[model samples]
Target: MRIHILGICGTFMGGVALIARELGHHVTGSDLNIYPPMSDALAASGIPVRLGYEPKNIDPKTDLVIIGNGIARHNPCVDYVLNQGMDYISGSQWMCENVLRHQHVLAVSGTHGKTTTTALLTWILETAGLTPGYLIGGVPKDFKETSRLGAGKYFVIEADEYDTAFFDKRSKFLHYRPRTLIMNNIEYDHADIFPDIEAIKKQFQYLLRCVPSNGSVIFPNSDTNIQDVLSRGCWSTQMATGDESGWYAKLLTPDGGAWECYFKGEKRALIKWHLVGNHNVQNALAAIAAADSIGVAMHDIEKAFATFSNVKRRLEIRGCVNEVTVYDDFAHHPTAIATTIDGLRKKVGEQRIIAIAQLGSNSMRMGAHGDALSFSFQAADQVHVLRPEDKSWDVAAVLKPLGNKAFVHDSVADIIDVVSKAALKHDHVLIMSNKGFDGIHERLLDKLSV
Candidate 1:
């Protein structure tokens, strides 16, 4: 089968293209923002990717058209597909029908930590010799690529709550009926699509309805929002992290690398690794419960936890120049920003945390978080907000409550200048952004090195 994918540069769509190629289909794709390393990955997989959407890129002989959520009505290729009555399905729908249908899917879904948790669970399954297939949004350092078709019956997916496509208004996770679902805490996000928290919650309720009675819904017990979502109705078995009865974790190390895991109050095994923070600890617990539910031994999970490498851009250290370390993170939400900073704070106590955050996400850029953004950065010694050149939110005014602790910059150059001058030895320069902050991490490193 020859499949043409529209908007294939996106992480999810790119992964889907790879999966299609691996599944023996000749896959070709096109996107307006066709850049590496997704483009490089597609090229390596022998899939030709056109730069932009046009009616010609649709491939007249194409067997099926997989439209990415990023594609909308104005796209010439989309218009052609609709006008010609070409068979089309969303990227998520294609995966559900072609790939996931044959496998036991384990989906990691939530507003935050989906990529990290998905990577962790996939590693756990791989370590247990399950050889699980996986589709992750970001490139996992453990597995150099984003998606693969494995020999095992298990498939691990990073389930996103975002709409599947312009035509399909439902959350992408709805199409993925996973046997094991990890709801890793939910909060209001994606201000462009969702009007309120309840609107997002309603979508979550639909996701819960898809799970079979034999399946299990894994989540952190501490989240009231998740508790509210489940209250509506949950037919599947429920597992909770941070609770004594279900599945819980006890932090041992000060850096939060070692955890004592218990299921039903019985000591399962001690998981020790290099990942930091209580959020990661919760992620580990969710993975542990999900893996154990599928019959993976606790000791095997311990081995996987010991060797699990984090996903790229999730607290990934870009470099250390002159004793000033620069870290990259995909933390755009208020909760994620707070957790990432708190995690780093645990690692480097008393060291000046120069938090360089980009309000790139729609929610953050629209000033939806308002004063909470200031509170999210209270843990950092100083917060540097790289105001998006396209969006005007008056971050300085939004962060007025923080006074001099917060500084807003109009350009990346200004941020680099300020950080280059202010960053000192032993300072942890944490750069947080969902998208590339105009390559600030490396540019900052070069400046600091000079």
Candidate 2:
């Protein structure tokens, strides 16, 4: 079958296209914004990607149109499909009918850490020789491609709570009937779609309802929001992290490079890795619990964790030059920003941690987090925020509590200058954004080189 995808450059939809191509389907896609590295990956896979949405991009031989959530109903291509009466389905729905239905799906979902946990779990399975199929939101450093169809029975998915498509209001994870579900932690996010935290929790309830009774659900006991979602009613076997009841972890060192796992208070395995932060420790715990449901031995899990390569853009060290380290991270949300900064702070310890953040995500741009965002950056010695011109919220007003510690600018160049000046020889610069912050990481390095 021939499939043409709309909004194919996004991580999720791009992964779908790769999987479709791997399954022997002729796949082509169109997106308004097409650039590397997704563009490079798709082109390397022999899949043709059109530059933008146009009625003419739809091939006469196309069997189906798989639309991504990024497309709206009024889009020209969508209107063309509707006017032509062509069959169209969402990315998640297409996967449900074609790929996920055939695999033992293991889904990792949360407001944060989904990509890393999914990558870690997939690597663990791969290291154990499971050769599991996977569709992660970002490219794992260990894999050549972001999505693949392996010979193993298990399929790992970085399940999202976001709505499936413009036509479907259901969360994308609902289409993936997971045998092992990891609820890393939940916080109010996607303020554009969800009106409140409870609305997001309700969606989680619906996802939990889909799990079979014999399947297992793992979450952090430290997250009260997750506990509230589970309290609504849970039928599947439950595992908890940060508590001794089901599965938990203990850090062997204050630096967070090594950790020990426990299952119901019994020592399981000691894992040592380069990944930093307590959040990553919790992510590892969730992945371990999910792996256990698939009957993977603790020793194998430990081995995989020791060598696991995290997904790109999650605290990825872009470069280190002249005793200064620059990191690229996808930390648009308040909690994610806090966690990423905290991890870096722990690693460097009193060494200056300079942060370059942008109001990229819709929630952050609208100032949905308000003063909460200011507190998230307390660990940093100084923060430079890229405040876009169109935002109605007063970025500086909200960050006023930080006083001289915070600097807000409407220009990317200004933020880069501030970051470069504030950063010293031993400092660590964390560049945080969900979208590309005007390629600030490399640009900062160039400016600092002078």
Candidate 3:
């Protein structure tokens, strides 16, 4: 099969390309901006990628076109496909038909932690000798590629709630009929697509409708939003984390690098890992429960957790220069930003923490989280926010609550200059964004090194 993917640089679409290539398909793709680690993975796999969405990029011999959600109507490639009467399908639908249908899919879904939890569950299955096929939204340090066709019946996926494609407005997760579902705490996000939190919940309610009666759904016990969605209807066996009634974690350390796992009031295992944040502890509990439902033993789960390296861009440390460490994190939402900062605060303990953030996600740029954005940076000593190009909201006014602690810049160059000057020994600079942030991490590091 010859396949051409549009918007192929996106993490999810890139994963789909890798899976298709692994299946012996001749796959090629094109995107506006291509960067690692997806670009690196694609190159290593010998899959060719074009620079832009030009109509000429699509090969005449291409048998199918898989469209990414990021690619909207009227893109030259999209119009070319339509005018040429070429067969087309969304990445999610193609994944469902080509791979997920044959495997027992274990899906990790939510506003945050989906990528990490999916990588964790996939590693758990791998350690148990299941060799489960998986598709993670981001690069996992432990895995060679973001997606693979394993030799086992299980397939783990980081299920996203974003719309499938311009043609199909439904959430992408609707197509992944997961047997084991992990609903990591949900919240209002993707404001460009969803009008409100209720709109997001309605999509989750539909996702619940996809889970079978024999499958299991795991979630944090304290999340009322998840509870509200479940109230609508659910046939799957329910497992709640962060409480005594279901899976729980007793944090042995404040940073969450070590913890004791519990299941229904009994000790299951002691998990000591390098990952931080209470959110990750909750993610681990959910992964444990889902793994248990599939008959993976507690000891094996403990072993897997011990060796879990975590996915890239989730509080991943990029480098340490002159005793000042720089971390890269994929935290765009206010809730996620708060949790990530809180975790690092606990880890560093009174050390000067500098946060360089970008309002990169559409929701942030549209002011969906503006009210709570200022509060999310309380833990950081200094907060520098890269002003969005949209200019729909006043980034400076939104972060005004932080007073002198916050600084808003119109360009990545300005942010890099300010942060590089402010950083000192023992300062932990956490750069938060969903996009590349114009390669600020390396540029800032270079400035600091000089």
Candidate 4:
């Protein structure tokens, strides 16, 4: 099959492309302003990616067009395909039909930690010799690629709640039909598509309906939002984390670098890994439960946890210059921002944390999290926010509660200049964003080296 994907640079769409290629399909794609590591991955796969969404980019011999959620109606490529009467399908639907239908899908879904949890579960399965096929939203340090066609019958995917495509408005996870589902915590996010928290929960409620009766649903006990979603209806066996009644983690270290895994009020294993944060501990507990449901032994899960390297950009250290370290993280939502900062604070102790953040996600740009943003950075000694070009919301005013501790900059250059000057030895600079942030990580490292 010859397939051409629209908005192919997106992490999900890119993963689809890779899996399609691995299946012996001739795949090509087009997107605007392409950047790595998706671009890098696509290039390595020998998949030709055309820049921009020009109508001419679509090959006449293309057998099918797989549209990404980011590509909407009236795009030149979309119109071209429609006018030409070309066959089209959304990426999620195609994934469902082509790959997921044949495998025992273990999907990790939530607003945050989906990527990490999916990667962790995949790693655990792989270590157990399952060699589970997997699709992660981001690059994992433990895996060579974001998606793969594993030899095993199990397929682990990072399930997202975002709308499928321009044509398919349903949440992407609705099509996954996971046998084992992990709902990590959920809060209001993707404000562009979702009107409110209830709207997001409705999508999750629908997702639960897709899980088979024999499957298992793992979640945290303390999350009222998840509890509310489950209250609507659920058929799968439930496994709760964060409490003694279900799978739980007894934190052995303040930073959550070490923990005792417990199931049904008994010690299962002691997990000690490089990853920190209570959020991560929760993610690990969920993964352990899901892996256990699949019959992976506790000792194997412990071994995998010890060797897990984590996904890229989740508090990954980019470089250390003159004893000043720079870390890259993919934290956009208010909850994610707070947890990430808190994790680093616990790990670094009293060392100065210079948090550089960009309001890159649609929700942040629309000021949906404006109120909560004020308290998200309390763990950091200093906060630097990159003010988006959109003036609809006042970034500085939203962060005014932090007073002198927080600084808002209008440009990447201005932020780099200010942050480089302010950073001192033993300082940990954490750059947080869902997007590339104009390659600020490398540019700031260059400035810090001077």
lDDT of 1 by residue, 1-450 (tens): 989999898899999999898888988988888777788888888889887787887779988999999788788898999889889999999989988887889999999889999999999999999999999999898996899988989999999999999999999999988999999988999988999999999999999999999999998888999999999999999998888978887789877888798888899899899899988988888988899999999889999988988888999999999999999999998889999999999999899999999988988888888768888998999889977554556778778887787898888999999999999999999999988788899899999999
Candidate 4 lDDT: 0.94
| Better candidate number, 2 or 4, judged by TM-score | 4
TM-scores, each model vs. reference: 0.98, 0.98, 0.98, 0.99
* lDDT (tens digit, per residue) of candidate 2 on 273-356: 989999898898899888888889888998898888898898898888788999999998888999999999889899998888
| Model 2 segments more than 4 A misplaced | none
Q: lDDT score, residue 5, model 4?
A: 96
Residue 184, candidate 2: alpha-carbon lDDT = 91
Error of 1 at 406 (Å): 1.0
Better of 1 and 4 by lDDT: 4
Off by over 4 Å in 4: none
In terms of lDDT, which candidate is stronger, 1 or 3? 3
The residue-level lDDT of candidate 4 at 225 comes to 98
* lDDT tens per residue, model 4, 1-450: 999999999889999999999999999999996888999999999999999999999999899999999997988999999999999999999999999998999999999999999999999999999999999999999998999989989999999999999888999999998999999988999999999999999999999999999999999999999999999999999999999989988888999999898888899999989999999999999999999999999889989999999999999999999999999999999999999999999999999999999989999988999999989998899999988877898989999999999999888999999999999999999999998898999999999999
Q: Which one is best on lDDT? A: 4
Specify the poorest-scoring 10-residue window by lDDT in model 1: 386-395
